[model samples]
Target chain A: MIRLNRLCAGYFGKTVIQEVTMEFLPGKVTVLLGPNGSGKSTLLKASLGLLPLTGGEVLYDDVDIRRLKRRQIAQKAAFLTQSRNTPSIQALRMVLHGRFPYLTYPRHYGGQDYAIARGAMDATGSRQHENTNVSLLSGGQRQGVYLAMALAQDTRTLFMDEPTTYLDIGRQFHMMRTARSLAREGKAVVLVLHDICLALREADRVAVLQEGRLLCLGEPDAIYQSGALEQVFGVGVHRVDTPHGMQYYCVPQQVPGRIAEECQNT
Target chain B: MSSLRIFSTRRSDIIFWAGLCALTLGAAALGLWTGSVKLEPAQVLDALTGRDGTSAAARIVLYSRLPRTCAAMLAGAALAVSGAVIQTVLDNPLASPSVIGVNSGAGFAVALVCAAAPLAQRYTPLVAFGGALAGVLLVAGLSQRTGASRMTVILAGVAISAMFSAGIDTAVTLVPDAISGVTDFRIGGFTGVTMAQLAPAAGLIFVSLGIVFSLSQQMDILALGSDTAQSLGLSVGPVRITLLVLAAALAGAAVSFCGLMGFVGLIVPHTMRRLLGKGSLSLMVSSALGGAFFVTMCDLAARVLFSPFELPVGIILAFAGAPFFLWLLFKQRGGRT
Candidate 1:
């Protein structure tokens, strides 16, 4: 389990995330839900040591994450950063980089590393574009390649920031399913997502943040019962039960009233 | 249970390497056979075997053509590999040794060494290596201080290059006599290099190439961006600095031998990426070979094109490289938005 204790982090001196505490357990999916600029990405980055800790420490099973060597931490935790640049590299080669923690200097990737990478590619259904340059891949294919890279890391803990952004609904479902499988395989999967229905349907637990503060953290149903998502996102939350599972739908709150007020003022 | 398959390369990779090898050999042969005295294949063979005595043809072949050809090949490979490393590390296609002021830094150091002590000229390669590191460090340090964004780094590099070029101008004005022997060097040509002089630069290039190859995987990971690379266990800052140092060493060693040759680094690596794809290892190897072929071919052209008049190889490269670089900049901008 990875735990954040009073974590404070940001760029330069301005703290984007402050005094936040959270715990991620193995064999479950913990989804971080927040509106824009709500410090979800910052909190995740701080926990992984990608951002400097201004106050508290991230403890991995009672040991400070910062105290451990990078490779040691990497051996346990893998991260999939927000989709950004797709390097002009072959997809399989990009996946193989996840084996870096296990690789020692002077020994390049061996057959075992290849096996792991290929397994990851197979798991993510990215084997079709294994030899293709990632830059040429479609949005869905590109996300799959990056997820395959994180999967190839083969860590006990995985963190993904906005993995489904820019992806089609089909790809988003595919990604969430893959994340579910990783959790099922006994990995701690933490993700930041904006789609509340996907979060409600897929997340074992959900943490909501608003203006750099944790509004609530609990099981998805409990958070839904608490009616916190409506307050955090300024939207009305409606829940329904489908044959598959619970489903959530949201609509912007008081839109007609706000427009009427603006018209009166003008 | 099913079989496990890991990393695999397409058949094109095999064909690419083979083609590059054959092309290099052909270029090398043509390099050897097409000098002023224009030796026949038999004469070239006899010269290689030391069957001929110290005839004028043998002297030209053994002393002049041999070292110049080797220098061109080595310089080309060094610059191209340096460019490839810089492009990957910076994650910007526009970044090259010359664009980032590495060449200007080495050139400034060479100028200073020459002006400081004419007899100490043999240490120019070492001093130039130090200078290249300092120059790149200056740019990197400044960019890091300002923000370390790709745009900031590129702007810092341009500023640093302008500053170093000014320094070079000052050094030349201060010591006119010091530049007499470096005239061909300043123009970036392999005119009068001897075997002994070419040896040290060759040593640096070969060793630095080894280091670059060993670190190629890390560099590939780095191209994924700093956050992802660091999260993957790479100490991004140190690995980046080390790679930059190695790149500086490469650009410096090349600049020490052949003055501030541009476009070989920019053009060769970019070409290799298009032809061989973006595997750093393949790009490194193929870029080195492609660069060697490119510069050697350019040198051959410079020698033969205007014949006795002879043009500097840099002139040939600039004509080819500048337009492509501009096109790349536009293409990158188009891709982004």
Candidate 2:
């Protein structure tokens, strides 16, 4: 389990996540939902010890992550962010780099590393185009490769930021399903997602953020109730029970003057 | 094919690279053999092997051609490896020691040493090395604020190069006697190499290249961006700084001996990238051999093209490298959209 105690982080001098506290349970999929600039990504980065924390501490199994060496942190948790700038030629080779923590100085990949990388490719369903340049791959395909790289680390915890942002609907589902399977394998998965409906469908627990503070944290059903989401999003939310399960949808708020002007113009 | 069979298919690539190495070595040998006072292949071998027959031929081969060949080989390999490392680190094909002002900085330092102090003549390599390190640090400091954007780093390099060249011009103008020597150095050539001058620079280049080769795998990881590198447990900052220093040292050592020698660093690694697959080991080795071959050939062309009088090898390299670079740019552009 990864736990954050009153963690505060920011860029330069200004704090973005202000004394926010949260914990990620092992073998569970936790979805973080927040509006733009609410520090979801910052929180994820802080947990990885990528961004320096101004106060408080982050712990993995009660051991402080900050006190651990960088390689040790990598061994315990693997992080994936949206903006990957890897060169095209180095795509699959980069996936193999996840084994770096295990190797000594003057590191070289051995047979075991290759085996793990191959297994990751298979698990993420990215084995087919392993040799293709990453830049030539579609957005969804590239995400799959990145997911494979994170999986290749073989950490107990995985953190992703907006992993499905540029993906098509089908690919989005495919990625979410992969995340779900990873959770089923007893890995703690923390994801910062923009899509509320998808988060409701996939996440075991949902943590709602407003203005860099945790507003609600509970099971998906409790967090997805009408008033909870309505208050969080500042809009009307409708909870409908279908044959499959409980479904939550946001009702659009009509702006009177803008619609009237558009109608007149049309 | 079985997986083992498939793996064995890369044998041809190895053979092809080995063939290129052989071809380049042959060219270097031919260069050493044929000159203004040409020696037969047998006489050249005798001269090289320290056999008695023609003392004059031995003098020409050992004193004139041998140092020049060694200088060309060392400079070429060093520059090519420097270019490849810079390109990989910056993730920009345009990033080279020459293009990014590292060479110009060393040249400027040499010019300064020549102008201000008599001791500069005795310690050219040290001055050049200091200047190269300073140039790399300056460029890194200037470009890092913008998060080391590829264009920003290249542009900063161009600006630093221009500034250093201007400084060199002013210094050379003040001391008219130093003008010709500094000018020759700036344009880059191997006309004035002696064994005494070649040994120190060659040693530095070899040591730095060894360092670069040792870190080649980490460099491959870093070619992917910082986040990816960090997630893989490679510290990005230290690795980048180490590569920058390595590239600067190699370029500095080359400039100290052979002046600027612009295009080998820019062209050889790029050419090798296309010929060999982009594996770091293959690229590093091929780049070294290809660079040596290129400079040796260019120096030979410079010697023969002007026969009794020699032109700076830099001119010939620029003449060849510029067009090839333009062709590559156009090819990349055409492929992009």
Candidate 3:
């Protein structure tokens, strides 16, 4: 479990995320929701100590994150940044770097390391590109490869910012399903996504932020019923029943005196 | 903390290494034999093993040609390895010791030493190393303070290089009398080199090489952008600084006695990268072997081209390097670093 206590952080001390407190519980998929510059990414980086905290501290299972070395923090959690370099290296080599925290000095990866890296590549469906150069990979393939690296990290917690950015619609759903499965396996999975409908359908807990403050934080259903999404995003939220299961929809509100008409149940 | 291999050794890579090793040995042998007073391979071996007692040719080989060849080989290896590390870390092909002003930093220090002490020549290598380290750290610090993007680092390095060149000009102008061999030093050569001068530079280069080679995996990790490297538990800032320090030591030691020789650092590494891809281990190994071969051949050409007049090695490097670099730039179409 990771707790951000009254976290106040920003670039150059502008305080993008002001006094934000939150807990990411294990065995749950937590999604951070907000408009552009609402500080979703800032909050994540601050929590990891990648940026300096202005007011509060992050605690990992009651231990202050500041007290731990970077290697220790890495063992506790894996982070996938939205913006990353496409180095001219083999895909398998990139995945192997996930085992870096575990590597001792002189840092040679042994036979077991290769096995786990191959397993990660298999899990992410990047096995075909294992020996290929990452620079030559397509956008979607690159996303999959990066995801494989995070999976190879084998931490108890995963934090991915825009993991589906370059992914196709099918791959996006596949990634969300993978996150849900990881949560089912008793690991914490946190994501920041703009697709409200997909997030509502998948996340166990939703944290909605408006203007750098938490608009609401709770189970997805509770957050939806509280109207926080409508309040912040000015949308009409609807719940529909399908043959498969219950589905959620978001439609823009009409002009004054007009009832919301686009949202309909299946 | 489970381990994982970053790069795998393949059969082609073995062939590449073996070929480069053979070429380097052949170049070294050619360098040792074909100087002003030529000696046969057997004669050279006899001299090396102290079989020719009190012969002038043995004296010449031992005292003169041997030191010069060793100097060229060491300089080649140091600058080439240094450049490869810098290119990978900075994520730019053009960010080598000479291009980024690290060599100029060392040249500036040597110039100042020559002007200020004149007779305290033995301390120049150590002073030059200090200057080079300071130069790289200053540029890196400036870029880091502003945001450490690849472009920022390159531009900062260019600015620092210009500033150091100005410093070198001032030092040379103020104490002209003290630096009698300033021109020769400006254009690098191994003529009149001695065992005493080559000893310290060789030792420094060797130590720096050992340390950098040991950290091949770390270098590759750093080559992965900062965020990825940091999250992977690499102490990004410290590790980056340490690599740069080693690179500076290399550039400094090479320039300590050889002046600001370019191209070996800039060109040899680029050539190796083209042949061997970007794995640090392969890039570094090829750079060592390839750099030695390139410099040894260039020194041989410089010695024999104009015969007794003896062209400085830097001129031959520039004459060859400029066109090769232009072709490389064209091939990459804006430097695909």
Taken in order, the candidates have interface RMSDs of: 2.2, 2.2, 2.6
Q: Evaluated on chain B only, what is the TM-score of candidate 2?
A: 0.94
**Residue B102 of model 1, lDDT score:** 90
Weakest ten-residue segment in model 3 chain A by summed lDDT: A257-266
User: When superposed on Cα atoms, how far off is each prediction in RMSD?
Assistant: 2.7, 2.7, 4.8
lDDT digits (tens) for residues B1-337 of candidate 1: 1122222344556777888999998899999899656678888778878998588777788898889889999999999999999888777777888888999999999998888888998987898898889888887777666767777788888988888888988898889887664556665888888889989988999999998998878888888988889888999999989998999999999999899898898999999988867678888999999999999999999999988878889988888888998898888778773
Question: Going through the candidates in order, what is the number of backbone clashes in each?
Answer: 3, 0, 1
Using all chains and alpha carbons, the TM-scores for the candidates as numbered come to 0.94, 0.93, 0.91
Error of 3 at B71 (Å): 1.2
Writing each residue's lDDT as its tens digit, candidate 1 over A29-141 gives: 99999999999999988888888888888998889987988888888888988856778788888999989888886658899999999999999999888878998898788
Model 1 ranges with Cα > 4 A deviation: A241-245, A255-264, B1-10, B181-183
Best-to-worst order by TM-score is 1, 2, 3
* Candidate 2 displacement at residue A117 in angstroms: 1.7
Q: What is candidate 1's CA lDDT for residue B117?
A: 83
Error of 2 at B286 (Å): 2.1
- Between candidates 2 and 3, the one scoring higher on DockQ is 2
Clash tally for model 2: 0
